[model samples]
Target: MQFKILQLVFLFAICSAANAATLNKQVRSLDWWQHASFYQIYPRSFKDSNNDGIGDLQGIIEKLDHFTDAVVDAVWLSPIFKSPQVDQGYDISDYRDVDPDYGTMDDLKELIQKAHAKKIKVILDFVPNHTSDKHQWFIDSVNGVEEYRDYYVWANAKVDDDGNRVPPNNWISNFKNSAWTWSEERQQYYLHQFAPAQPDLNYRNPKVVQAMKDVLTFWLDQGVDGFRVDAIPHLVENEELLDEPKSNIPGYNDTDYEYLDHIYTKDLPETFDMVYQWRQLLDDYTNKNGGDSRIFMTEAYSDINHTMLYYGSADGSQLGAHFTFNFYLITDININSTAQDIANTVNKWLDAIPEIYTSNWVLGNHDKHRVATRFGVANADGFNMLKSLLPGVAVTYNGEEIGQENGEVSYEEGQDPSARDPAIFDKVSRDFERTPYQWDDSTNAGFNTGAKPWLPVSEKYVETNLKKEKADPVSHFKVYKALAQLRANPTLISGDVTVKAVDEYTVLIKRSLNGSSLALVFNVGNDTATVDIAEDVSKSNKIVLTNVDSSRDTGSTVDPSNLKLEAHEALILSF
Candidate 1:
């Protein structure tokens, strides 16, 4: 027994030294974003400055300290460019100018400088797929200007036997309408994959491509670190004016956007090339100008195979995006999700991702329902732990750290374009998730001092707000901060990840670096889970972090051979 104990002690010492050496070597080789935590801030719902009822750039600037306090390494603000507010800020009227609703151009420059000073990289939303109909280029195209006529996809109307003019094709808009709209001035039908007010740019036009590249350079010159390319799959479409096949999904009709397969309208081969072009532009700019890497976080809501293409060529020769936003964790896991279900979703991406490129995890975003609301409030921190512990970037939406749920918003109070149709408002309204941030228990949840916030504040804000959570010793916000700190640790940053379903109720994730191993065990079911992960983690048995709903405490010892996890609980154990 004495000899066995001595052997274990000597092995432990060697592992510790190996961990230190591996950490030091890998820390210097990783990029600034490889292991960083990225927080997404929706400008309209974040905070309201000047009391105009809408959030502005100044509001985010004021909240910079909050990001630093949370240890967020980078933040991506959703579309601050000038727009008519048709699709919030997604409809870009001017790529170079800051919207008057948000702030001035000088305000943006100031934000970039201040954010950099705080060591936070700033990524602006780049909407290259389309521009608002009110934009000068679109207006010029409508007026038949020779140079701008082909700036957007325009085709002649199809004349039927009845002599009635029909849209060029049967493609549907994401807004549940015909993709083509008649331009009275030009007497041509223009394609708008999103809302009719937002016309898709003709990327086939070299001029349009060059113009968009110039817009990127303009923002780069302004000192913005990078861009979150929005609606990337819609950048280009099948040019042959073809009709899409019916989706044939039950309980849906032709009137619904889901009625069609969208094969011709989405995930086209040309779209990948377009993304590659933007990636080249970003890399070229970084090469010419000496600075930290300017990355692209392309937003492509497609299958895992197509999504991975955004990372670059399969051979990994050509560089595409630093990381494509992975939504598997967001769209796949929910209230009834089992541990095996989660393992499958995560492994699907992990297996498909090329060996050279990095991986990413996203639980929620402005467009989706809050994780607490979607995955059950009890399971919020468990999923958050999974996202953070995964061996790659972790993207967080605002208010998620505090376990904010979707607010109640009626059809009459809804502002989202997709929810405009009252008949299906409840089914499609994003207004619930886009409600004002719950800062404190004050009026308007401390998001605005004005008479009213642009959107209603969640009534539970009084109890669920950040102020309330911050005071709690065990809270979701505390767990998130702890995860953020752990993100910087070498074992997490450079370690290899191994995930498995311990049982139907529990999932085990192990990150091992050199000899040190850290384990993250999640109990996603509704009962106590007794799991034995001794084979997975044998170095240490100290609980380093616990979910907000966990009954266990950090710094407590646990027997790897027999670990107890409460329902919806997650624990990070260092071994």
Candidate 2:
């Protein structure tokens, strides 16, 4: 009864705050991500000044206008926190300080202020799941200080149901290794759910949750608009030390393909409560200046259907967005089945989740190959159109506007673990995903002047650079700009989504807010497929945008039986 009452009170608070979230707080010419299109920068590969050969925080500030090249409303920088750089800055050595390699706290403050001046809010990466081994907390814990020791999960051995089990527990790390690592100094196996260098924090401990909450507070207090919570689901593993028995979820990923039953660990019920607490913190901070709280979109390990629940506030209130539409996951393209898969997965959440203040969407990130490369297209215009036209707040990764393909990296250049175990990794290639941004045809593709880029720039940089594309009005950059700018139009961002096939080769959608409607036609085929619109759409409504075949001649042969579309193209129509 106490747990039930506690849960009810928490839910009540979440609902109340979520209702507040809908207040539609606008930030200096920008709406709450509704009128905004976000662009993600790897930071290291965005730009480099001082010829330091690494992209610095100052470099990002210098090149802030570059994102304006694509009309993005916000910029999300991958982790620049003090780190050992083991997981490319995902492992934070310190929470409050900026990494010298990136720049200084002053530089970051300047970046935020400057971006806000451009009407672009800045969102930083928050890695609450784990910390770098070098973090003071972890260092102090190894000293057998019971205070910090319980801050992380440390086990002597997993008590197996059978006597002869080797690992004691079958739970495997997403990075494909034993979840527990032997810490010689502590003389106990500590949980390193990712790499030995990155230790997972035990959120089951009140102090652990409070510590992470403090981290969130530190950033929000610094005027950050939001956070992209990294690996959110793995924060609290089962205390019993359980793993997936390797039953049915096959072909989903090789990352969890090993023989470990994860039933007793991961995706625990408390995880949702943790997100609630984080959401509450975000909510309180958002209301700090009498505005909506910072967004709480998490990259929790849940699949499409499971993520919607995260959007719900802890007290049955609406949580912030939990959307992640990654191209790396759906690299395979088929006209009929892929279209259905896309529609089903997306619509599932759109229907299931409430009208939360935020919804999740993405094109590419640092962890996957460029969307252009993933789509097997030298230019990913068709796919980008498909992704952006979805009825939600969409995010485009760096270099995606120009259809940046993946750049090649030698063994030394690859910073991700997925790149390390290439044999085990089923690569349509994830390494291509982490290549340096191709900004211009300049010596280093406009990323840096130094000979050795941290990662090589795409050779396509010559044609893909913003300089050339800006002049060629038909560039993907322009298309994305148009689509992004329309997010503020009320219909696209806050409309009811109705996705249906216009035909076998074309998937059609309607984003309707009130009675005003916008219908998008995506021709995912090679041949021009005719789509005859027999719906309420009449020839009188103006066609707002066209991506596949540019001519939006509604009066010309676009009837129910004769509607047509070109191959691998998408079109958005608003009335």
Candidate 3:
């Protein structure tokens, strides 16, 4: 009997060693971005160092330690280039210089150095689709300079029977009006798919394409890890100007951007080619510079099929972005959404993502409402777990770590260009979510020294700020930190994923490798839920992490065969 027991123990030891080897191999295969945490900062609202009402690069440097503490892998900053602030820095006048409103070029350089010292990668927002009308190239194009005349899309005016010149086509700008604006000096109409002050660049011009490439090289030289290319679907349009089909949506005015289908203007084939070319440029730069891979992340708010195309060609000869921004979590899942709804949304992306491509998850951004506010404060931690453990890159917008909510910005206090039209200001205003970060309960939520914030701060800052959250024994910040740390585990990084709706209101996600696994059981509904996950759990049954509102405690053992979760509760288990 003793001899038989020794042989059995030896067999078990061999099995354990083999499983450990498999876990190490899987962990070694992942790239930096795979299973990494990314934090997006809207610079103007992050922090203000000089009490200038606007956040700046200097302010970011002061708070750089925050990301280090949070275990973030990268930071993506919105546009900081010289601009007239027409679209809040989307209108770039100079791609190389930092706008005075944000900071000087030296300040940005200092920020990069400090961020690097903390082992954090920096990504800048690249606006290549259009430039500020005040840009030197646009100014020269307006003057009809021989070499610059083709820098922008220009068309001959269409003459009606009354002899009055009209726009070349029925194209409408996204800002809500005619897309073409006539220039008296050029004697032609210029295409502005967005705001009139932000004219689209003519990619048909080879010189223009190379000029943009040069801009990318300029930033790559500055040591930026990558770029978040904005509005990639708008990079190129149909050469032959054509009127888009009407959307025919009820109640929307004809002047509204939603009045017409955007077939001719967005998601053009050439736009994908443009993205591929930029990807090539980034790849070539890394080859020559001998550093970490510089990535290109494209932003295309198109349908799922169109958005996936931004990844690369179907044949896989050309690669576009490292990973296109995934907004399904932000757009599809809501407060009242069911567990099946969440499962379907997750499956939609996992089904569409190319086997060769990586995945990304975005919960909120500057343009959208805060997740806490959108899905209810109680659900914030639950969703964060979903985003963090999803077998890919997880992006967190500023103030998300502390469960910040949308601020109250009255119409009169709104500064977003989209809110300029008073008639629709209340409906389209983004100022509520773009308010200053709440650091403490002090004035302006401690974002600045004294001056009023650019937008109103949320009044809930007293209990919702980082200081308060960090102090609480059970808080969003604590849960977020635990989730961020778990991202480095081999099981979470490259393990096989299984997601399903355990019930109508609960989701069960399992990431397993070898014999070890991590499981997330979340109740997204309003009522309590009892989930039997015995089939999903393995030998170890420890609760690793729980949502801020969970009644359960971490490090406790529980029977996966019968688990009870309160409403809006999420628990991560290790087995």
Alpha-carbon local distance difference test for all models: 0.86, 0.68, 0.87
Question: Top TM-score: which candidate number?
Answer: 1
Candidate 2, 11-116: lDDT as tens digits: 3333234434432342123346654577888888888876677788988988888777567777888999999888889899999999988999999999999988
Positional deviation of 401 in candidate 3, in angstroms? 0.8
Ten contiguous residues minimizing lDDT sum, candidate 1 = 1-10
Query: Using lDDT as the measure, which candidate wins?
Result: 3
Question: Which should have the higher lDDT, number 2 or number 3?
Answer: 3
User: Which is the winner by TM-score between candidate 2 and candidate 3?
Assistant: 3
Model 3 per-residue lDDT at 257:
86
TM-score of 1: 0.95
**Per-candidate TM vs. native?**
0.95, 0.86, 0.95
Residue pairs with backbone overlap in model 1: 540-575
- TM-score winner between candidates 1 and 3: 1
Cα RMSDs, all models: 4.4, 9.6, 5.5
